[model samples]
Structures are given as structure tokens and as C-alpha cells.
Target: MLAALPVAVLLFDDEGLAYANPEARRVVELDATAASSPPHVEAPAVVDAVNRARRTGQAIDCELERDGRQWQVSASPTACGQVGVVITDLTEVRRTDTIRRDFVLNASHELKTPVASIQALADSLRLATERDPARAASMLESLEREAARMSQLVRDLLDLVRLEERTGEEEPAEADLAELVRTQTTRVAQAAAEQGMDLRVDVPDVARVAGSPGDVRIVVANLVDNAVAYNRHGGTVTARVRRAGDEVVLEVSDTGIGISPEDQQRVFERFYRVDPHRSRRAGGTGLGLALVRHAVRRLSGELQLDSTLGQGTTLTVRLPPAPTSVAAPAQPPPP
Candidate 1:
């Protein structure tokens, strides 16, 4: 009967190991002798099961975890009043459960916030239209703006989902970090045209890095874009890239309205905005900093931010220099 059981079983008296099956030893890495020995921790379930089974002479079970290992354990008493116990490992099962719960919670909060805002704006517009024509017009305008904001929020959320799914150990190789800056700046330069903001780049031609070009672009370009977008019309956005010891430093400084000490801590959180009305009106998606954080981690880099409200902001990214194996090519040998 014990041979037919799926679990690892151990039988013993108050003294020690009277019996131990193969499964118990395999699951807990315990020998038959060690099985019946007093367990390090008190297992009430095992003690209760042993006492009850001794009276009925029946089999029973329990569950427990030790040293980060999950196990289902059972205890029973034999006809002679001795105890029988079993343990089965469950580490993988518990890990799967935790991952599932976190995914569900994060997804729910992200999808719900924008949806609630949109619904409230629509309801307000409807009430205003019924009571006052002039107020209705104002409400409609406000509703339109909120609807656009919600639309952008939804788009950014979708982008985040896609990025999260795609994040893995893989990254780009032998990427000319400087070129990426040149290309993206050229494209975003037009957007800053109306602001009269000056976009300057100071990257050497020989400089190159080893990482995903796309990720590095996301980290640096996003910061520069944000700095330029948020700056005053006549502000300056200066981008500098250089090697400092074993790290590469890429910085973007702006003369825009800076962040307050309060909003600084939360700037990296999804959907957080320093100035909700202004950010929304400017078509800010609120996912930029979150994206920056993700990209920085992927590149094995650090991001530093400094800002003073009413003055400006500066963002710096420091990445480990390309590995020795991937450093810029050696110069040609002399004749």
C-alpha cells in the first residue's frame, strides 16, 4: 500500500526513523535516518495528524515550507501507534502564483485610471449642455481635451505593454551611440522649431558603444525630447556625450520650467505628471520617464536628474564603457 502512494513517506515513533520512503528523501534532500528525526521547526499539522491517525489508524496529510522550498507534508499513525509522514516540493508552483498576481494587479490599475477619467469628463459635458448653453460650450471643449488626453494615455499604455513583453536579456551590439543621437535629434529637431530652442550635440566621431542602439536611443533621445518639449520658447537644450573613466556620460540640459522637490520622486511613475493640466494640454503621455527607467536598466546604466523649478533641468545617463572585447577598433599599425 505504501509503495503505491505517490508522496514520499516516513514512519517513526517518538524516538526516531522507523521507516522512510524514497520520495521524502528526494523532495527534501533528506536521508531515511534524518526523516524521522525531530524537524527543526515545529509542525503542528504533522503532530495533530499523527495523534488523530493513531486513534483511527488512518492516513492523513499537511503542507509546509522550509529554506525557500515549498512542500506538501502529511502525517499518519500506524496500527502500532507509530507516526507516518510525507513531503512533496512545491517551489515552482508558488513562484508561478506570485507572478500571476503581480501581472493582474499592475495591468488592472494601468487600464482603469484613464478609463475612469474619460467617463467622468463625458458625464460632466452632458450635464452642462442641459443647464446652460454657454457653459455647455466650455464643457464640450474641456471634454474634447480630456478625450485627447485619454487617447494619448491609452496609446502610451499600449506602448508600455509591448515594451514589457519584449524586455529580455537580448540587446543590440557595436552600436554607434553617437549616430543614434544624430539621427533622432534630426527628426525631433523640427518639433522644437517653434519654441526657438537650440539643440546642440557634442559627441566625438570616434566614440561608439556596445548595446542596443534602439534602447540607448530611447534613453537619451527621450530625455532630450522631454527637456526640449517642456522648456520655455527661448530655452536651450544641450546634449553632450563623452567618455569618463570606465563609463560613458550622456547628458541633456534644459532651460525649461523645472520640477519641484515633491514631483521629483514620482516623475518615474507611470501616468504621474508634475502639472496635470499643463502636461495634458501639451499632449504629454506621462510614460516617458517610466520608459527611460526601463531602458536604463536594460543598458546597465544609471540615470541622474537635477532640476530647480522656474530655472531648468538636466538629465544625465552613465553607462559602463564598452567591454574590452568590444572597444573602438585599434588604429592601423605604423609602417
Candidate 2:
């Protein structure tokens, strides 16, 4: 019965290890002859828990880290004058908890800035309207901008949630990657032009991929938007799509203030921004790249980033090609 348990179980007497189940043998080194030599548990914490449980004749629980993994060890006195031990892995659980905590803190911080600005702007606008009529217009404009920023943040948050919860229940369809690049690029071209930046698009006749059109559009739009948003005045933003063997490749490159090596590693993380001030000024929600990352992963695609601090940054995405027999329909330009 002990051998059938899923968790690691061991029976140890005062002399040493009397029995180790298959699960326990997998977790710790067992001697060839259990009757002669004691088994070795590399983790000191586990050994201590067993010794303490035997000495006190009570159950003792402890946690330990071994071989870069987290383990929860429980040792208890058995009826046969031996200590019974159980070990369960807790690495994924602890890591998930840490991620959940960080995500909440970051989301709260991101929302707080816009909320506070909206509150202050409303107060100033009221004062301006009453006593400083000349400045009232500008205050109203500022208030609108803050409201828009918050709205965009909420929308992006929803998008992130949807992407994370995607179940792939719907059949994948063939989406024209080339068309998505062109359409998303055009949508952001005016913004690029307003910033005195040149926008360019290079796409093949048809670069099709097997994925949901919505997911592909999210990936393309965010990349193009980021290129335009982070670029310097008079910089160039290029959106390109091509067929690469069995994959469809989309690359967005920008001559902008590039990300540092350290920042690049974490840019896809939710609410992470290399230039927080600039990001806010550009009406960024700081969730665009995160949306792109999630959408790409949902489609079983690969994403890569290359950048230099002052020169430029380029993001590349490769997705599986659609079946040869599938036909991609024309997608209307985004409004």
C-alpha cells in the first residue's frame, strides 16, 4: 500500500532507513542494502524533520529547497517505532503565488497614476472654469487625455485576460499575415506621421498562417503601435511580412530609443515599460507588448526581440503556415 502512494514515503528507525517506497527512492538516494546502510537525504531540512518527529513522537512539517526545486516534507511517528516521511513538490505552486502577487501590485500601480491624474484634473478644471476661464479649455483637454488613458488601460487589461483564458475550442482558420501587417500598419501610419516619423510596410502577396484572425491582428497591431509610440521624431518604423519555409514571419523594426539588454528580457511582462514617462506621454497603457506576447503564444508562435540602447529595436514573430488547401478571405481594414 505504501508503494502505491503518489508522494514520496519512507520509513526510518533509530538505526536508519528501514523502508523506502518507489516514490521515496526517486526523491532520495537509497542504499543497495537497506538492512545494512541508511539512505541519504541530501536536504538537511528533511533529515532534521525526520529526526525531530522521531524524538517528539509527533508529526513535523518542513520545507526545503533541493536541486533548484522546492519541496514540502512531512515527517511523523509511525506505530512501528519508525518515522514515516512524505515529500511533495511545491516549486510550481510557490512560483505561481509569487507571479500572482507581483501582477496585482503592478496592475494597481499602473492604474493608480491615471486615476490620480483624472481626479486632480477634474478639480483643476472646475477651478479654471470658475475663475480662470482662459485656462479652462486646456484643463478640459488634459482631463480628456487622462480619461482616454485609463480607458485604454482597461481595454488592454480585458484583452490580456481574454488571451490568457483562450481555450482553443474554435477551429483555427487561415489568416492572411501579409494583409494583417498592411492593415495594422496603415492604422498607425497617421500617428507615425504626426510624430514626424516615416512609416513603411513590405508584405508579400499572401503570407498566410493557421490561427485566429483576431489573435493575428492583436499581434500585428501591438507591434506596429509600439514601433510608432516609442520612436523618435523623424525616425523610421517598418512593418514587414514574408513566408519563411513552413512559417509566416512578421517583423516590426523601429529607429527609436532602444531597450536596454536587461529591459528586453522583461519587456513582454505585463505593465513593464522601459521609459515610464515617455510611455505615459504617448498614451501607452504599458500592456501592448504583453498582449502581443500572449497572443503569439496562444497561436503556437515564436517571438524574438533585438535591440541596441540608442540605435533601434526589432521584434520578429514566426507562426505556423496554414494548410495549402485553406483559402484566406479578405479582411476589412481596421477602423
Per-candidate count of clashing residue pairs (backbone under 3 Å): 4, 0
Model 1: pairs clashing at backbone N, Cα or C within 3 Å: 8-24, 61-74, 62-73, 172-212
Q: lDDT value for candidate 2?
A: 0.85
Q: lDDT at 180 for candidate 1?
A: 72
Q: Model-by-model lDDT, in order?
A: 0.72, 0.85
Expressed as tens digits, the lDDT of each residue in 1-335 for candidate 1 is 77566776777676655655566555555544554355432455555666676667777766776677877767766667687777666788888798667646654765566567768867876787787667877766766776776676676566566566775567447567766777777877887777788887777554566677777777766787688778899788887777877877788888999999998998987667787777655667767888888777767889998999999999888887666622343344349
What local lDDT does model 1 show for residue 150? 68
Tens-digit per-residue lDDT, 1-335, candidate 2: 99899888888888877778887777775554554567666667878998899889889999877678888999999898988888998989999899889988988988899899989988888888899999989988888888888888888898899999878477859788887888888888788889899887777767778888988988998898889988999999988776666777889999999999999989998888999989888888889999999999988999999999999999999999888823233344459
Off by over 4 Å in 1: 1-159, 162-168, 324-335
